[model samples]
Target: MSLTKITDKAGLHRHLEAAMQLEHATIPPYLNALYSIKPGTNTEAFHILRAVAVEEMLHLTLAGNILNAVGGTPDMTVPGFVPLYPAYLPDGETDFQVDCQAFSRAAIETFLKIERPAQGATPGVDTIHKGRKRAHHNGHKRHGTALRARHVPGNEEEHFYSIGEFYQAIEEGLERLHAEMGDALFSGDPARQIGPEYYYSAGGGLMAVTDLASAKAAIRLISEQGEGVTDNIFDYEGEIAHYYRFEQLLLGRYYQKGDARGRPTGREVAVDWDAVFPIKANARIADFPEGSALRQGAEEFNRAYGDFLSLLTRAFQGEPALFVEAVGGMFQLKELYYQIMRQPLGDGTHAAPTYEIPHG
Candidate 1:
């Protein structure tokens, strides 16, 4: 469907504009660092960051669809739209910083600021809270999270606290959606939300949602990122096309689809295990000589990562508001992590640290 044209018409034009704009905001820094790297050395970090960056485009498109279905002009060009990242969103604790010089760990910090929930824990007054219906399902999902982070360094086992509570909290929002939309809730034209023509990213995560429930669920699937699927804050429907390019570089094969869904799957998922990552994960720690900037970076990183995880424990219940604190704490630690990761560790490789949810 031409974005300029539409079939069904019932949505907020401004809302869609805002969503897509939000999505587009992330493109630059990711672009600068990904393309600036030396070809084969930083593969892991490159692939991961590039994959994530492309997916952000897809998110922007999806946001556009929601807007277009309701009669909105998808505006990519906005004043200061590409404003440098690490630039604060409406309510970030610290100004998000996205300097092009050092991306390794710093990129993720800017990202966390963008991705981590905003502060203002007070709902309705400071934050808005919708009432609920299907609290149970969300509660069930909130049961636990595989990824737990801390501001204070910790082990994987320690970060496994149940995400069930967060899911439960989100249920209130879902129930609110149903209450507001009623039957139109799950019904939309597949051509309207999901489309195969613009497949982007690794898994071709976009499913061309055609109904309200599918719309929410389709977008929701994106809430989680896996090998094949990922969601970018941009909300573009097809920006992901840029993601698998590095994969294309590594696997020496491009992603294509055999399914009616027009998504990349199965053998299409091939990769060259031998090919080195395009960017540095900085997984090594011995190349640099002792007492260098690199050595200092390593120590700083361990402590910062530790802090990011500790904050995750307080809001494991899905309190988006609490995520505000986690988000803020994450940034502080993120800046520290970035500085440390960028310094060339004596050896140029650092140990990869894993997280375990704390028992709180």
Candidate 2:
């Protein structure tokens, strides 16, 4: 049982940067399923997806805060920042391909996989380890170029079994670095931290990370809100974990207090699986012909999404105040999404936002 190690500052930077990217990776797919829901339908599913997406944004901000706490710069503008469609999450699973598809049972299943809880490992001690043997379920093709991000940069194949484990490794590394470097490890600029005032999300609230304690808290909150809350169906904040929230849509019932695992005894949750737009799975801009309305809509979406990322870059770098404008920018994307959604692709499926951040 050899474990991956983050032995230096540069390695920590890579891991945190990957953490930010991992958090951001879940957003587009979730949004794809979220916005894909038809008007006046799938109300329960919509709120679940929307809340989880917003929490992912909070998680991203917390990751950036931890990165900045360790004197590392947060850059969302880099190439490979926005992964290709059907991108693999950093959860170390090779079986599931997170796709940009419309709302359906398949999408909910993928969401469940993305937020699946870990079993058998304690948080700080035995969480991070080598990757698992590859599985052949789900019929998802492996993308050779986009390997699972490992703690050791050169060894991209090794990865944590769960995203919580990934962050746990980062937390452990922070403890080690803090012991070695003491105050020097927390030398990052304080001005770069995004405090609670700038972020308000359902799962959790944001906190500024200034030292090892705050840094560890930021990392732990992300895991708990995502998968670390597996010990209980609901987290300390009394909100259901993202995994169970999505599970409600599948089980056709909401989880109630005192409900056992895998069984929710609450009121029924109605899922209109047939009410989605049937957006093309894993859509790319190249799929649409040039000069077509769908093509222009997809291209315009990419440009607007690029500008949103730029706003996020500035907010993460030092201008935390810009997050308000960035939130506004996020809502603005919904219009572009609707524009593409309204344009039929003629294949009985409508266009979806490809999230292909334009490269400059």
Identify the candidate with maximal lDDT.
2
| RMSD to the hidden true structure, all candidates | 17.2, 4.0
Residue-wise lDDT of candidate 2 within 1-360, one digit each (tens)? 112467788777877887888898898898899899987888888888889998998999899999998999898888778878887775455555688899899998888878877746323434434543333233666542232334344443445657776787888899898899997998899999988788665456789989888888788789888877355778777778888888899999999989987799999998889988889998889888888877987988999998899888999888989988998888889988877876678889888888777878
Task: Show pairs that collide, candidate 2.
Answer: none
Q: What is the lDDT of every predicted structure here?
A: 0.38, 0.79
Highest TM-score: give the candidate number: 2
| Whole-model lDDT, model 2 | 0.79
Return the lDDT, model 1, position 207. Answer: 53
Give candidate 1 regions above 4 Å deviation: 1-15, 84-86, 90-97, 117-178, 181-194, 200-203, 226-360
Candidate 1 lDDT over 1-360, as tens digits, reads 001111123212333343454455455456445543445655655676667665665665565555433334443333333333333321111223333333444444445434432223112322322222222223322211111111222211111011111222222333455577664543433334434443533444555444456446544543433112222312244333333333333343444533212233434433333232123432334434468665455555544544543433233212224435644664474454444433433354332211111222
Off by over 4 Å in 2: 1-4, 121-157
